[model samples]
Target: MIVAFSVTPLGVGEEVGEYVADAVRVVRASGLANRTDAMFTTLEGEWDEVMDVVKRAVEAVEARSPRVSFILKADIRPGVTDGITSKVETVERHLAEG
Candidate 1:
């Protein structure tokens, strides 16, 4: 499964990069397959392991602000591995062929 999410700390003025970095740190340290883009951080693993990381990441942000905004999207296909890079590569291959 691949889970892509973003964590934003509310009421933290105009800049929340530091708080968002806290969440990304948690994701990076989890030893899971992951990627961080400008908009979201994505990780792939079993449901329990993935959710555990996400939970801790949200908590990291929660500690900094009274309110938090989280957005998540998941591609929960079983029996699939490395969908993180493979899925994107597949799309790129199609585009190159066109």
Candidate 2:
């Protein structure tokens, strides 16, 4: 199974694009593919791991800019899109297959 999320950030000034880019990189680094509009699809070992990754992703940004004034969130859920879910699921299958 896989958990996916929609990541949204607000009030980003100056380097808004850069900030967004960094966040995207973080998710991709986690082997998650971001769909569109801040949504990411990734695999987790379990439910807890999925949430933990989401938490870390949020913290990564918060830790960077305290004065962020930038509001952010990740909307995580399972089984939203058939393909996305399958895509994330592939990660788990591959891990086991390896």
Candidate 3:
């Protein structure tokens, strides 16, 4: 299964990329998944593996900063997952169905 998830803020800024990097590092270190890049990443594993990545990402950006007000959205999917971009597509499909 592929699950795509992301950690984003209210506004776009330099921190946006930082948060992604921080979270990706945690995921790679967890030994549950691999880190592809700072902004984009791909972790191959089961549901637990994917969830672990998302949890780490949440911890990485649970602060109230000037740019990062809060988590704008968090989406997960199956089959194959990337980062924010693919996750957004998953979201769009759900919205369209609704």
Q: lDDT rank, highest first?
A: 1, 3, 2
Regions of model 1 farther than 4 Å from truth: none
lDDT (tens digit, per residue) of candidate 1 on 1-98: 89999999999899999999999999999999999999999999999999999999999999999899999999999999999999999999999999
- Candidate 3 clashing pairs? 2-79, 2-80
Local distance difference test scores for all models: 0.97, 0.53, 0.57
Model 3 alpha-carbon miss at residue 58, Å: 2.0
Candidate 3 lDDT, tens digit per residue, 1-98? 44435556545555466666676677678765454544445555567766766676667765533344322222344565444355568899999999
TM-score of each: 0.97, 0.46, 0.49
Candidate 1: worst-modelled 10 consecutive residues by lDDT:
11-20
Predicted structure 2: lDDT: 0.53
Residue 70's C-alpha lDDT in candidate 2?
32
Model 3 collision count = 2
**Residue pairs with backbone atoms closer than 3 Å in model 1 (clashes):** none
Q: What lDDT score goes with residue 91 in model 2?
A: 94
lDDT of 2 by residue, 6-60 (tens): 4444555565555556555666676543443544434443456556666666666
